[model samples]
Target: MNVSDIKWEYIFNIELAIENFGYVLSGIGYTLLISAVGFALGLIWGFILSLMRISQLTLLNKFAAIYISFMRGTPTLVLLFLLYFGFPFIGVYFDAVPAAILGFTLSSAAYIAEIIRSALNAINHGQWEAGMSLGLPRQKVLWRIIVPQALRIAVPPLSNVILDLVKSSSLAAMITVPDIFQNAKIVGGRENDYMTMYIMVALIYWGICSGYEVLQRKLEKQFGSY
Candidate 1:
């Protein structure tokens, strides 16, 4: 039972892929925009969460712990649904793009918070002592000595988060955000060529993520040097 043995022909319409090539590719901009902006905001929020997680104050630590646990336990899609759909019931409403951005930011920050916490915790306590012994203030010691080392250790995992965000940005399609996957889905439906459209979208996502992985390697080299 091979290709010839099949009763009906399985055709991948290259014409449809070629015709809608630009249509699908156009969504790349929105996809990148969402990922870049979300990741940037999430990183900042995550850093704050990381600090809170490691804070000596019990309230801050507990709050950060519960937040991270809740975000991690729930599905990202549910968060998106709550933001885009459920929020309207409470008198909150967000447009598609904003909702998608906020959803990713909130979800990614949870994972990033843990990554940052682990990295920060990995730094040697002696490094902190050494900085203080050199007459540095606690703030200065943390910023100059502790954070730099931790960031170096964190580059790889943080890079992984970025890649994850890029791929996960496809989820924006579910809410009619018209990102790459959404546009592809549109073309697939209109043309009745779902296979080609989906395959093209998958390749595009692969290409984008492959570039991030390459950048990750370069970042590892740069951070590893010092």
Candidate 2:
């Protein structure tokens, strides 16, 4: 803990980071692949959940409400652990990558559902009425008119959720997934330079998150112009 014993050089050893760059960069593909699949799956399932939440059927509405509540209340790490470790009791087994993707998708769906629902609710009822007056079926009106507008409103928040998922994907390391964090840990252990390697990992994550933020802003501007 002494200042001299801290190995301050390790923190700024850009050359060390560069040397291990390929090792860390190699994990980016897995990270991006998982995030994309997870977010896409979550979006599809979440849309259904949102529809259920807003349905006329009491049973559907109740089911969606309970699901959203439970998922939102649970932590992502616990969900990951449950999927990776707890499934064996039911005779189900998932490899690290599948478990991580499934865990992220399930957790993300709850939040995305709520986001879509709120955006849908915010649309003026007049739009729905107008579509109905145009001789459109309810489903047609929902899909053609309501959903398009709701999605525009939902994009910013959805971007935030996606960004969070990207960062949280780092937790895959805990399950022995060879993600960015896991690679960093391996390199750090081998070099005995934990501080520098982890800093590099943090910067990589920061860069990715910042890129998402930029995209979100551009999307917001485009959507706002409509």
Candidate 3:
């Protein structure tokens, strides 16, 4: 077909895309909710795993290592399906949002654990000795002095993980969660403008990631001073 004969209108109807903008935007709330909750829960769980991985106990260290390895080895989508679809076999049930949150949290925790563990390892041994010399108990020193410094060191990497979680939130669409991607699909189907709607969705994700990048830089600067 000649270029002029191509049905460009079907591929990208800008007016239809514009009309459905609200539908796509509406999913942002669910996207943000999933990422925020997932990141927070992941951080908490990851910190616990980090502590276990670094502990003196052999069993704790081994368990943490295995758990982290398994989680990191699994693809995120596979994990999402396992939780959302596979759970029913074990008689556990989860709504789409909860299942997505659980999957993201589990997947993110593995990476976060490694990030925290590496940060902890980067601290000079003298810091721990100094804290001890100051008459602080081991637990006190860990919680107060060591962990604070490690977390400061971890800020940059953890920010990246948070951004990843935000992007991964889009995968919730597979489980029927009405996240941004799902909303875009719905709008595209209704408008028959898949290309336009998907491009708009991409821009929305890009905008969110770009905003986080700015915050990450500021955080790095603030933490670098410490």
Each candidate's clash count: 0, 0, 0
**TM-score, candidate number 1:** 0.96
lDDT per residue as tens, model 1, 156-178: 88998899899999988898888
RMSD in order of candidates:
1.5, 1.8, 1.9
| Ranked candidates (TM-score, high to low) | 1, 2, 3
From the highest lDDT down, the ranking of the candidates is: 2, 3, 1
True lDDT of residue 179, candidate 2: 89
Give model 2 RMSD, 1 decimal: 1.8
Model 2 segments beyond 4 Å from truth? 1-7
Clashing pairs in 2: none
Over 1-226, each residue of candidate 2 has an lDDT whose tens digit, in order, gives 7888986786768889999999898999878877889999999999999999999999999999999999999998898889889988899999999999999999999999999999999999999999999999999999999998998999989998999999999988888899899999999999889998989999999998899899999988887887
**Alpha carbon deviation, residue 94, candidate 3 (Å):** 0.3
